[model samples]
Target: MRNSMHHQAGFSLIARVLHWLMALMVITMLFVGAGMVATVSERHAWLLQLHKPLGITILLLVIVRIGVRWAHGTPPLPSDLPLWQRLAAKLSHLALYALMLAMPLIGWTMESAGGYPVILFDGVTLPALVEASPGLYSTLRFMHTWLAYTLFLIVQLHLAAALFHVLVRRDSVMPSMSTGPLPGAKRSKG
Candidate 1:
């Protein structure tokens, strides 16, 4: 029982590292994106430069993350968790992965459609995903904006759920990805 519980309560170190790293990057990207859209000054250009490469980086990381997840499955939810909660957890994760993937692709395509080069850095330009079309660019821009809003809301919900598991239910969910043992977790005798 102790061994099984320990296994269930901890994520592999690589998984934890990836989780925290991507979380920080995603949060930073969100703010940078907001700043980019809200300004028309020189800052906007600077932010745009940052946003493009960051988005691509996130896209690449998420692909690697998905591969890791597939190779090493996540810890199971507490067996006693309510069915509704389980369903919600699964659905929310699916949504998160989908959005994480979709947002970058849409942004890349939008830029392509707008006839803008996706320059990662000096002399490094990504090929366009779509041909330039003003109409398509407009449509994709609308999608990218609404999807960003949706992603923000979902991220909030994910955070709330993690807190609920830690504070309200006093469960192992958060500790699975936590570097340190969560309060109330059992420690084996040496």
Candidate 2:
């Protein structure tokens, strides 16, 4: 009789790298954004410089990440996970990808409306997405800030869920995102 279990490898190397890289970039951007709003000092300008290019870079990487995700479908959740967890996981991931794409775009539009160019690394400038307008800038700035905070909250929740999976359930979800071999892929015969 054949065993019911199967061995499934973890995510591909490219997906793992992109996941970690985006995670780091998102965390750093959140901190820098907080700092940018907290102070009126010259450091704000420096942070803005970092923020613009970083946002642009994230935009580019996310575009590539989408392609990678399309080519390599997401790893499946464990079969035993509860319905609520599976639902939450799916919805939360969708939200994350949407926010990751939206925040940078909103910021770009905001800057464009504010008459600021997205000067990327080494003076690589991105064209404006919209005509400069003070009122439009205000609206986009508000939406961007609101979305950033929402993204931050959702990211915290995602992190908490990952920790719960690792520490509480001790599941394979967390391991699947890493560079190492998938744990417990081989099931022992009864």
Residues 41-126, model 2: lDDT tens digits: 99898998899888878988999998887766666677788999988988898899999999999999998999987787676889
Best by lDDT: 1
lDDT of 1 at 160: 95
Tell how far residue 29 is off in model 1, in angstroms: 1.1
Inter-residue clash pairs, candidate 1: none
lDDT of 1 by residue, 1-190 (tens): 2223344446678779888998898888888988898989999999999999999999999999888877666666767789999889988988988988999999999999999988999999999999999999999999999988888888899999999998999877888788644445434221
> lDDT score, residue 154, model 2?
93
Give the TM-score (vs. native) of candidate 1: 0.89
Off by over 4 Å in 1: 1-8, 180-190
lDDT of each: 0.84, 0.83
Clashing pairs in 2: none
Of the candidates shown, which would achieve the greatest TM-score relative to the real structure?
2
